[model samples]
Target: MRIAAGLIAVVAVAVVSSSVPPEPRRAAAQETAVTAGATVETEPVAHSGDAADDPAIWFDPTDAARSLVIGADKKGALETYDLTGKRIQRIPDVYPNNVDVRGNVVVAADDDTDEGVLRIYLVDPTTRQLTSAATVPTRVTAHGLCLYRSPKTDKLYAFPNSVSGRVEQWELTVRGTVVTAKSVRLFTLGRAVEGCVADDASGALYIGEEKVGIWRYGAEPDAGRSRTMVDGARPEREGHLQADVEGLAIAGDRLYASSQGSSDYTVYGRMDNKYLGRFRVVNSGGVDGCQDTDGIEASSRPLGTAFPAGVFICQDGYNLRGTTVERQNFKLIPLDRVVLPIGTLPIPYP
Candidate 1:
């Protein structure tokens, strides 16, 4: 999660509570060595420091080659880029921390006001432009956000979580150019939390409690607080996850989470919630590797000749250009390059 420059020190202290234990040190050799490389990298965000945050892929159904990547510039805007990594649009003055897109609707967790808000936008398929639709206010301080379109109910929902661990599920409705929302459920995960993704096919919502591990909950409006631990951060448990579990993404039957403290990503089975493996994005082919990553998005849908088997987008916290430090940006890697020790099984897209 990106914090304002002035509040960085304050947030650092607030994130680690007394109940949480300090992270244990793990040797670099102990972590997975499998690596993937990026083929395309987006332009840096307008702000100088700690700006670029999360990304959501908008797959153009009619023409996958025309798909776009929408990202949140925590400093104050939302930027969109085409598959070739060219910046297409920038909606400024909105301090959004996380972003998600489903169908024609794009939602961002905005903290520009005293009360957190969800900035809703409608995407023009042909033009690939985002038009402001509505801003629904929430009680919590929005930090992480994701969208879900239930296959069972055919209704759209947004899950936005705050740094305080409060999560709110809102049901969204769109009519023509206008959008509306109603708060359906609210609950806290008991620690600072951020990353979240919903499995529309299984109706499961997974939340990452920064210091703890991943937890699963039902995505239905009436699902309530009941949850099951999918994995843990406790060193003794020997789990792949490290501290500060950041962004989460689901592609095919696989679930990916950014293990920030370790500079790697851990994968799991979307259907069974079983640990799959871990991999890192390393420097190769002129593009720098991803380190201290914050958000990531993956799609199994082929996008042109560049990414025949789809793509994986990551927010590179430490963007570099031939050893020269540059302003933060996002990186694009072909999904097929992400090879796991136990090869990924084919699962029909949801």
Candidate 2:
């Protein structure tokens, strides 16, 4: 009788343990926390909109400390903020989805009105303000924009992608102080495409297909539709990108891409598009951690003491302070700080 009772108790305990879900037990045992470098968050944007989308850093030609960080408030205007995070200027009545800087020109993909075009603005280096230049109609609705200057031919071009997956390259010309654009070539990446950056030195283009992954293509207009999948969002695979890779930016020879689905950023080799590693902007020095970033911009050229070895800017999906949820803003992380963990430093520009 004593042996029977002992056996029944053991069987009962085993049955109860088996009844508990295996998934929860497995998850508790297998899940591990990911570590990434921390970043510094700048002051929030003036207009508290959920539309603080993309950022472009325009360095001052004469004064490095007086550089301006231009942000696209996709809902209303293009705003310019000083390096100290003060809103200096705002261009109203324009809805810019993405913005990029090439030389003295600030090209943004506009969706404010019926005219789907690129709004060109000339940057006043002295005042660090953007002056209205001209608008070049792109026919296709512009969603994401990037400025590319060809190293082979020294031609200035703009690549804009539409929500319908149409990507076109436009050759931009400057006549006196005015800017205009002419279509050079067109291509597509099937589904929704956005977040593109060009490496003029290597003549390569990196674009993110929101649902798919990251792709590398030739910047030349006639480079044909040949493209290589640099990384895919496969959770099962090691070092694979999570879904919705939204932003692409190049810092020196490396590329930084936002993996929105994972709430982290992935790095890759700019020339070979090889997988490097992944990082997340964590809370540090009184700033909240970043989540679900959309657009990002990086510069290899150092900008004053704030960014001695260049800076990497990411659009914050959630901007919160204390209990109050503030407007979405951009966070600036020193490039050296970001690459320090991976043992990669900024290579000198040739």
Candidate 3:
């Protein structure tokens, strides 16, 4: 009886995952996605409009003081917070919705305004404070921000997913606090894409589309010049992961993504959109009552030698009941604490 039940469950996931349109519209005809947390309970840092939208974590075991994770509250403010869950200070004048960090620097793409710009922050992770680096002109609505290191050239990349239907990857260079951007590479998806993440170890990038589902890009310096390596990913269905999928993370070999409408998360270990499992956000004095799911990130949640690393953090979409205008807030939940895994991945993000 249990065997039949198990088969039925597998059949359900397969049907939902394989439910793409038929034809030139077929997902098998589209490029595939082979890509890519846990955290605690915290009283998220509040924003003036939406409570929490996006989060980026920078881990430095050598310098724990300098290790930090930054999140966007998406009202008119940006926030700096430590690993143990402490508030740093509110960055005044930022309209950023997504946050991604590397080393001591963090980059956020500000949406809600028409300026089309990327805001760079010079961060002192120890103090949890930041100052403006420079504002670079982004051609469209900046939605997702990530740091990528090119494997072929070993050059650093700061890629931003914008509303203009193009993903921009820029080589990064910094002298003290000033950043000089170079070798800008813009790769066009068939349409607008959001929620992008990069795996520096393998030199690959994964892009998630709001209107569509998810797509993969090889991103070699020469390859990014053209649109060839995208794989067999389907356009998102209307009621599933379709509700504003805005975050991506990798653990071992699985890629985890959040669907805002259902207030739930979906996991796919391999390149394909096979739903391994699903988990929802449970509200407590937390912000989810106001917002749906938004940004997400992952790290090793250390328990003991027996278990692999396990923490995950999620960003809230709205605040104060989603009725009044307020900022977004960050919520920390451990992966092991949230869901049971079918298999343990060798490395995060295949």
Candidate 4:
């Protein structure tokens, strides 16, 4: 999720003036004590400080071992990494807060432009590298973004949201190497909002309001602003979600979200939105755990032997090497190691 423009500028100044980085926050007691560790850690972002924000995993159907993981460096670049955690490609000169992929098309919410735009790219299947295709402008100041391919129509859609709660849905079309987008729907969520994900199978859209909670809306273009509350932050109700709800992703019948305030991840039943449990990544096997996470992504498709049941990727806010803090980076966890609620089935890739 993108921080408010005003706050970002102020924080930027402080970071520039300070020689020493601040200490990382500790995680408080949670409802569940379950924990897991990352199997792979990506190379740190090019810039220092809070530059790494979100990630997206692209499954290579032809060759599972060739699958790629793409991430956004809010400090002005988008990076692609291989299954072994090596940085393969870096596209510079753009401030992308969040990124998502559908098939071969990768879209990032570019905040560098005056009126936020979506930087589009098509991945080369053979080389597994991203090639710039087009730049589509958005109506709102794009802070968060996610892509969806409809099950009914099979048409691609992009949901780019702003810090002011404005979200616009655009239909994207690709012909040859050219790409275009058309606005189809718009709505406001009342407060500062960011993270969002679309359930193509159920036609459901989930949006996270930083101070409030997550809301459910229709993914169809004609579906109006009518929404239902899926879950709320503390003090509002008895729930697991902490304030500043950030990146969201779906794996099979479960929905995963970054509980930013507590430095953990919360799980819910995708069908009923029922709170299942929560877990934190802890230090293990020579690699440190993830803390103060900002963005997360998960997949259920088998990807090689290491991640046979799939993998989960998260942006580690405080990349620590023992007690000392290092540059921010993403962690890859084997999904099968994460214990889920009872009756959760392994749904195939969408």
Top-TM-score candidate index: 4
Model 2: weakest 10-residue lDDT segment is 20-29
The lDDT per prediction is 0.82, 0.74, 0.58, 0.81
Per-residue lDDT over 1-350 for candidate 1, one digit per residue giving the tens place of the 0 to 100 score: 22223311111122333322122234222643466788999988988677889999988899989999999999989999999889999999999899999888999998778878999999999999999999999978888998888878899999989989999999999999979899999999878998899988899999999888889999999887889988776443446777778899888778888887776788888888888677777666777777778899988788899998878889987776654557889999988777354445366342
TM-score of each: 0.90, 0.86, 0.73, 0.91
For candidate 2, give the lDDT of residue 147.
86
Q: Write the per-residue lDDT of candidate 3 for residues 1-350, one digit (tens) a residue.
A: 01221121101111222221111111121222111122333345654434567787766445543445577766676876665567766787777778887666778887666745678878764555688888777756677777776656766677777766677776778889788776466777757666777776565677776666656676555555433222223244533364455687765556677655444566665444455655544443423321256788876534332223555677755333322423446666645544435455456431
Residue-wise C-alpha lDDT for candidate 4, range 116-161, written one tens digit per residue:
9999999989999899999988999998998888888999999999
Model 4: runs farther than 4 Å from truth?
Answer: 1-30, 235-237, 342-344
Stretches of candidate 1 exceeding 4 Å from the true structure: 1-29, 234-238, 339-345, 348-350
Ranked by TM-score, top first: 4, 1, 2, 3
* Preferred candidate (TM-score higher): 1 or 2: 1
TM-score of 4: 0.91
Superposition error at 188 for model 2 (Å): 1.4
RMSD of each: 7.5, 10.2, 8.5, 6.4
